[model samples]
Target chain A: MTKKKIEKQLSLPFRNAFQMSLRSLKIRFGRSIIVTMSILLGIAFLMSVFSSNAFTNALIEKGPEALRATMQQNSQELRTRSIWLVSLSLLVCVVGIVNAMLMSVTERSREIGTMKCLGALDRFVMELFLLESLAHGLLGSIAGAIIGIFAITIVFLLQHGRLAISVFPAGALLKYSLVSIILGTTLAVIGALYPAYVSARMEPAEAMRREV
Target chain B: MPKEAIVRTIGLKKTYMLGKIPLPVLKGIDLEILKGEYISIMGPSGSGKTTLFNMIGGLDKPTEGKVYIDEVDVAQLDAYELAWLRCRKIGYIFQTFNLIPVMTALENIMLPMIFAGLSTDEAMEKARQLLVTVGLGERIHHKPFELSGGQQQRVAIARALANDPAIILADEPTGNLDLRTGKEIIQLLKQMNREKKVSVITATHDLKMLDVSDRVVWVRDGLIERVEDRANLDIKIGEVEGEEAG
Candidate 1:
């Protein structure tokens, strides 16, 4: 028999990984929703803070001189507190994402082993996980932004009547929403990195040996 | 006619670390499997049949020595090459029938072909044909959870043949089935071995496997205890029992 070199087969396209990730997210919808909710709450808090700060600045600029002095002091303190709260909330969000991803990896160890046995490369495994997290981040952030904008709009309508719409600071609010969405997506991918790497580097035999 | 050896293992050894201590699983095993042959490696739980199976399938690297599949050294291949070898040359069937839970039976079979670079349409067509071949033609759209144990195993068998692999490695293929179902699985495997001309190597505790295997390798204490041709084994126990009943 002639000795044949094992030629490299074509790597699977990115579309395959994307489709698989979508299917997985659908199949594990409950878990995906939980993960998304964590991101949603955190981003909602962030967007609310941003828009409120923008509205207050608009108010301070247009108020009487005496009212402006007092309002500036109050706004400074509020900004400091909100920053701390937002940072804390975002930190909790990252932790939540990391925990969820780790649990997902553990639960699917056998499935991972089966995929490896079926010729999935490490890159493919990583791609599946990263893509899944990206989807969660994108959806959660969009929903959170909308809720945050709506809540702030309602609060302004009650507080200042017609004046709230006149000084809504729409431009600043849009910019902040964009920032929050990008941050949420980036944090999600970062949180999933360790779990994806661990799954990608798993030993096929050892993974299969695990009962679950 | 001289038989061509498709899988060859030379002094393969594997050890697992139990915390601080070393526990040897496969001390040293040398074996050869011919092309288009059906062989069973039989042993108890701790006898290391699975370890040897892993070695031959390239699922794990041996602690020492070499495993050659189709005259190519498995240990020498890089990660990419190993993936290619696994995708194009070897098919694996697990006792648990580890089909992806999210995928339908048809999709599960198509996955391997997709990994091997087939277009979705081509993979689906071939997967559909394989499902029919395994007698699960009507269950192609069903998820694994919706299928019975035997039905799921049939899907797995079809998945194993997805890429037209040269070899099939089954680890306790029938360990989860009842006697009748197990016999059906064995018959399916034998038929695949004959029809596809793919080498079939199984690690099993199923004595029924001995009836169809070209050779039976009994493993004990992480070593090949003996190798026996199927013809030489005393398989007349069933007949003797019938005689006693008469």
Candidate 2:
């Protein structure tokens, strides 16, 4: 093949993958929305835990002179508990994503077979499923971050008459939101990989034989 | 070696493992398809016509023997090569109109061209032309659910023609349609075969296909029981008598 031909072949999979992902979202609109909401709630729980005034204040309440001593005494205990809570919430979120993706793959066996019959590469199939999960992850995480910020603001306003922005550090919340987005995306990809792999490696004949 | 035989199979066999028992689906078959010939494979359910079709299409690997398409041994080609062959060399139409329901008819038709490395504009141009050829130009924007069973099959035929493949393998292309619609689809397929000179291999129980086929293959119990040329169709009567006698 000429260079132009090679380039076209290389790029074709990405284009098809993109189209396949869009089609998947359209076909499974309801299920996708539910998965996104689940991720949003999980990330929301994470944000609430970190942004809640009670938690932040508990760490910052001690005076500077005693801060070093308090940090030495209680920092390890607080960090461990926070880690556990965050881990548990993210775990729940990942489970939901995996369940949704597994169902999606199972339901689309015929579609997958049809794609394979049309000469879709395994990489194309992988890219399709991965992109779908990534889209859901990003959307859900952004929504969760915004919801978390508003939620923290509401709690602070109720606790104090003013906005009380100082109660939650802007810098810290921004960092946490960014982290949540990355974590959510990573979790979504991980959860979707196995099912996508299975779908991609399926024999076209066997996949076609399966009832949708 | 016949210069015109585009597809050839030798001792092709496929066995499925039902638990520990080796249940053979295709038992040692030899067949050849000449270029641009319309061949209909007629068989009862579970007779392995689909298995043989799958082998020829490179959709499944045979347990034993070789399937050669245009002189390339299918078993010798790696997965990537096989996929490319499927994309550029063969087209498939299914009984269920196995279209991606989320896609519009045009998108479905564009899929194989896209796989064959055609740019979006090129694929779209050819897809539109194929839709027109299949008489589905008005339904290009419709999803599968929006189209009737006959219309969906038309879209599928358009899709099967997307890449302008050398061979079209249709597995019961009219199995789901009403008789009138089925006849129309068969006529459309015949028109394409004659005009485009693309070989068509249809595995079906529909006798209407015999009218358009250049030859007919009868399969029974995982074996090709007989092959009859259109000009010599009296052979079917002889085979029936032979079976009755045996």
Candidate 3:
């Protein structure tokens, strides 16, 4: 075949990979939802903590002269404790996403074999898993950010009544949500890498035999 | 010169490592298949017929020797090149009807074409045509779980034809079906081999294969015991099956 023809043929495999990812998510919708929930909760946790920290920092920056020093001391302590706790929760969530993706890869060995036999390249196989996880990450992160905003708002309302609204800066919450989205996507990609590699390197014959 | 054989294997050999023991699968298989010929590799279990199919289809590498498809040495091709060749030149069907369960019959049929780089519209058109050819047009929207064994196999056949491959390799294509369904599947394969001029190489122990194959290659213990043309098939296939059963 001509070079142009080869390029033309290369065009559809990515589209097919994307479609395969969608089909997989739909077929395993329950598992997908669970994975999404893990990511959402993890990101939401981080966002809420960060938003609260931002609120404390803002208080120290603009609080009454008499209260600023004590508030600064309190903010330092809260930041240190929350950072360690948030980091631990995030680690657990990453591990959970990795475990979920690994299971998904194992369950689809035969489907992977069939795709490989049909001429899917290793990269295409990798792309399918990565895209699936990425979709979950984007969806979960967005949802988590929305929920985190409400969570931060609720915590502040309960703690400080109507004055809590003034202390919870809109700009700070947006920043926290943005940071959580990025972290969620990064964690998801990291978790998916090993599973994608496992799926891509599977021998088609062996994979099919496993299913049979 | 005459046209080169569509598939040729020279001294093809494969061995597996089972702990410290070595198990030979294909012991120096040398074979050639011509275009449009319907050939069957007949053997009992452990005869390495499936291994031979995998070699020719580029699904596995041989420990020794070479596989040449359309006169191109398969070993010399990189992974990308092998993938490209598999996509555009060969199709495979399995006994278990390895259709993606999550996909509808139409989507399964369109898969190979998608890998071959056809646009969605073009792939869908070809897939629709192939489904009709395999008599699964009415069931195109059904998932594999919803289809009968025969219908699922038909979907697999349609998927195999999606790329319009020069050769189709079927590994125990009817092994999972009933007698009547097996016979029907064989007939469909034969029809495609004849009308489309697509070479077909099937590994099967089914006695009915003796009726449809242009040539039969009997493999024993990872070696080709004999190759016989249909016109010169002196042994009674049914008697052979009965003897094996006994």
Candidate 4:
């Protein structure tokens, strides 16, 4: 085959991604579902925290100085707790992603080795993992966005139908979406780095060997 | 550092030190594999045939030596270059037929092309042609688990052929199949070698597996015990490499 044919053959994209994801999914079937769920839970927690803050903001507005002082103190207490929970949840998810990626790459060491032996470049291999990470993160983010909004809406009713029509969540939605995207990309890259590195480094012979 | 050898090794040594005491996997080995040559490496368990393969294949670095594949000293390459060489040149087949389970047989075969950076359309077209060539034209959409062991091995062989590599290294392509299936797989591999003219290297404990190999190399205790041409294979019975029956 010509150089062009081989190059054309090796540069397949969506199929590669789909294959990798499927393999990754089976290799860590239980963990992937858990990861998706964990992401959902984290986003839900954020939504609850935001709506609670808004609720407290409304309650504090209705009172006199003495009640206002108490509400202010309570509000401060709520902020501290919410911030702590959010931070903890984020930490847990990060660790989870790291673990998921680690397990994924480790299990597929032979496969990665095979690819390299067949003449896959490091950047392309890196991109494979990076792409998988992106897909997972994006899928999670999309799911999280839809779930988060619903969560926000449901909790908003705790204020006794004060919000009659759906308010345009301009700044808040945009900010959260940006934040999630950033988090997703960061997590995806961080997750795939070590594994991709090991894969890119493997020699073809060792990669093809039978364990027994 | 020999000029004519596509793969050359110089005093290759790999040692695993456990708490200061050293356990050597490959003691000191030197050899060469020229282009388009079919070779089989045979040894019992723990004989280090696998380790030797690892070092030569560039899947792992040698502790104290140089390995040159396709004129580039693999031992001298940084990570990026090594990866590039692998993607563009080597095709590996594992004993387990490690096709990605979620993907169809066609997708599994398409993996190497994807790694080489082919656009999806072009990659798919090539993948289709390769799959059909391997006689799995109708099984393109079937996942790995959905296929039989022999079929999976065929898909793997097709995948190895996907990159049109300089060498095809199979650890034990038919290890998991029945004897009949094993023979069929060997025929497939031989057909690949003849048609594609790609070099082939296999590592197997199955004496039955060496019939089609152009050369059979026996490795014991991390050393090349012997290398025999096809005509001389009948005169030699390989020594046990590692595991012994009680």
Candidate 5:
């Protein structure tokens, strides 16, 4: 019934994972706060960057028929512009991933020590960090995706429906959102590992001596 | 005597490698402690009391010899087994009363139980009983930083007892307390020893403590120089400090 032996007796990795995460979150509330702030900042940046992307998309989609009247003069230039804008959105998301991961790691030093001392294995410690990063990434990217979709709609109305970009690729948008979220979390786990290891390998006496 | 020897250390040593050459801290030392005994290990700073305490508590291992707790060689245990041993059989209380500052007194008491996987209802019941035993039943909701030093120590005492460990190893438990609070903590330890039949081992430089201990062991330069009963505690020969040897 003691806390240390519960995992061995219960076979409850899922419950333990959550308990570890909550314990980590409790100990590193300040770090959690900072991680949340970074996530919000990254998502906000994604939204702003992609809002303009939606506008460009709308511009490219519209006026295609009009340009068809003079196809040789217009088609190639518009195609190049569309590729350039899509690349810009992709670049923003990559930057966002890197930014979020670094901030999350910097805030969670003592927490890793606490977990390791409590009998967490090497892989368990890694998974806790990974889980935290995944949670932030999932929440952030979903919010970003929904905002990007809404931003496209807003951009379409703002331009008075003149842009011809397909307004509704709901399935592609949903699938891409899920992919980016997973990718963002994977990047966060990588960024979090070095810090978590530095924190985990701390000598127990040293950690016990630490005031915090 | 064999069954009573809950902790035994033989020729234990530890050396810190400062830049290449090892700086020895604990020299070859041998000592045995019995179950349910109230003993105090006393010495001045740099006498390696903390190092020895950490070693016996399974938080660290000696480089040279062996340490056994309850017939199980701690030095032979792997990381997971060592942790389990520490969490289940040995309870440690520190000088700073290292209860998590964010947690309430009751929460700190229950953490070991929760970690050990007791059901919420059972853990709470045990925690409440311990807090009452430590005389902290009313302050259960107060966070560590919010409580006085004595109160915080009480919470730590409760935490140490939460899992019902056999040996309560305290390293300078009252180091940070004032005289009044410190003496009160000593009294609490004595009561726990008598009533709960829990073995208590404390390391302190406070000479006032040797008066109260059933066995007073003097440690100097990483080795035990003497083991004395309360009557023999009056002798001055080979004691840690000439000034404090009563």
Candidate 6:
């Protein structure tokens, strides 16, 4: 009898992983929304800080000297405080993401076992999780950027009246929004990494044996 | 004529770490299952029947010895190859009817085929046919939560048969179902075994399964206590209560 070499298994198309992740996100919409909210809040704070800094700069460069002098006096202290707040909020956001993802992995241990039994590779499992987090991050970040810009704009208009519109920092705000979006996406994926690895490394038998 | 062996285990052993100590689950099991055979492994809980099933299905590694499926040594395969063997060669059914809850019955069945790289249209067509075969033609659109226990098991059966695997490893496929449903599932499995000529191996406590199994292997204390041909032993449903009480 001759030994037969097992043919290499085909990797699942990215489209399948994308669709599967999308379907799961839709099914667990409430949980997805809660996770997304964490990203939203953190990115919102970051974006607001960015927009405010840009606004102050525009006011310093373009506003009346009297208003500019006061702005300059307070901008340094405000920037320092906002930086600390943004860093703290982002840390909280990452913790929230990691907690939610870990819970999700634990909750789906049986499903993961079933998928493995059905021949899903560890890579496929990881891909599904990462893609799901990516979607949440993208959605949350985009919404947060919009909300942040609107909020800062409202506050500035109230504080500085018509002068605020004249130096709204629209161009800088747009650039900052893009940066916030990318940061949010990267943070979400990084936060999900440990959870995804945990799920992927699970032995099928152990996972199935788990009561959860 | 002797049937070809589809699965063979030689000195298969598995030990689990119970904290500081190693507890042996399978104390060197040696067994052979023929192609197209319907075999039932019966044992009380903690008797190592599930461990044996997992070893045969390549879901767990053995601490010693080898398992050959269609003459391929399971332990010798790398992770990718093991996955391929699982994807295209072996199917699994669980006691709890572990269908992907988020997917409809059709999609649940289609998943394995998708993993096997089947085109979406082809997988869908075959999945529909398998659902019909499992007597779930009308429940294809329902999610597992929407279906009854028996219906969910039927979907799982269809899903297990998705890739035309050479063997179906079912760990107490009917464990969670009522007697009538259990009997129905046994009948369905036997029918599939006959029609598809796919080997069916089940670890079960359901006595109804013995009626259809060609051979019954009784396990005790992490070893095969006896292997009885169906014709050699008479089984009564009442014996289940007696066995449980013991």
**Top DockQ prediction, candidate number:** 6
Cα distance off (Å), candidate 6, residue B208: 1.8
- Runs of candidate 6 with Cα error greater than 4 angstroms are A9-11, A210-212, B235-246
DockQ for each model:
0.60, 0.40, 0.43, 0.40, 0.22, 0.65
lDDT, residue A129, candidate 3? 76
**What is the TM-score (0 to 1) of candidate 4?**
0.79
* Candidates' C-alpha lDDT: 0.86, 0.81, 0.82, 0.70, 0.69, 0.87
> On residues B153-225, what C-alpha lDDT tens digit does candidate 5 reach at each position?
9888888877778898899988999988998899998888888788899999877677668888778887787
Assign candidate 3 its CAPRI class. acceptable
Can you tell me which runs of candidate 4 are displaced by over 4 Å?
Answer: A1-32, A62-70, A86-106, A145-149, A163-185, A192-212, B1-4, B117-125, B235-246
For residues B48-106, could you state the per-residue lDDT of candidate 6 as single tens digits?
99999999999988999899999988877877888888888998999989899889999
CAPRI-style class, candidate 2: acceptable
User: Which ranges in model 5 have alpha carbons more than 4 Å from their true place?
Assistant: A1-30, A43-133, A144-172, A190-194, A197-203, A209-212, B1-3, B234-246
User: Which 10 consecutive positions of candidate 3 chain B have the poorest summed lDDT?
Assistant: B232-241
lDDT of 1 by residue, B1-246 (tens): 999999999898999889999999998899999999999999999899988998899998889988999898887788888878888899999898999999999999999999999999999999999999999999899999999999999999999999999999999999999988999999999999999999999999888887788998999999999998866755653653455346
Better of 4 and 5 by TM-score: 4
lDDT per residue as tens, model 4, B27-47 = 888878877777888889888
**TM-score for the second chain in candidate 6?**
0.95
Top candidate by TM-score: 6
Candidate 5, pairs of clashing residues: A2-B116, A3-B115, A3-B116, A3-B117, A4-B115, A4-B116, A61-A164, A61-A165, A62-A163, A62-A164
Q: Which ten residues in a row have the lowest lDDT in candidate 6 chain B?
A: B236-245
The residue-by-residue lDDT of candidate 6 on A71-184, one tens digit each, is 889989978987887778667666765666567667787888888899998888888888988898899889988988889999999999999999888899999999989988
True-vs-predicted CA distance for residue A78, candidate 5, Å: 10
Preferred candidate (DockQ higher): 1 or 5: 1
**How is the predicted docking of candidate 1 categorized under the CAPRI scheme?**
medium
Give me the candidate number with maximum lDDT: 6
lDDT of 2 at A171: 70
The chain B TM-scores of all candidates, as shown, are: 0.95, 0.93, 0.95, 0.90, 0.93, 0.95
By TM-score, the candidates rank as 6, 1, 3, 2, 4, 5
Which candidate, 1 or 6, would have the higher TM-score against the true structure?
6
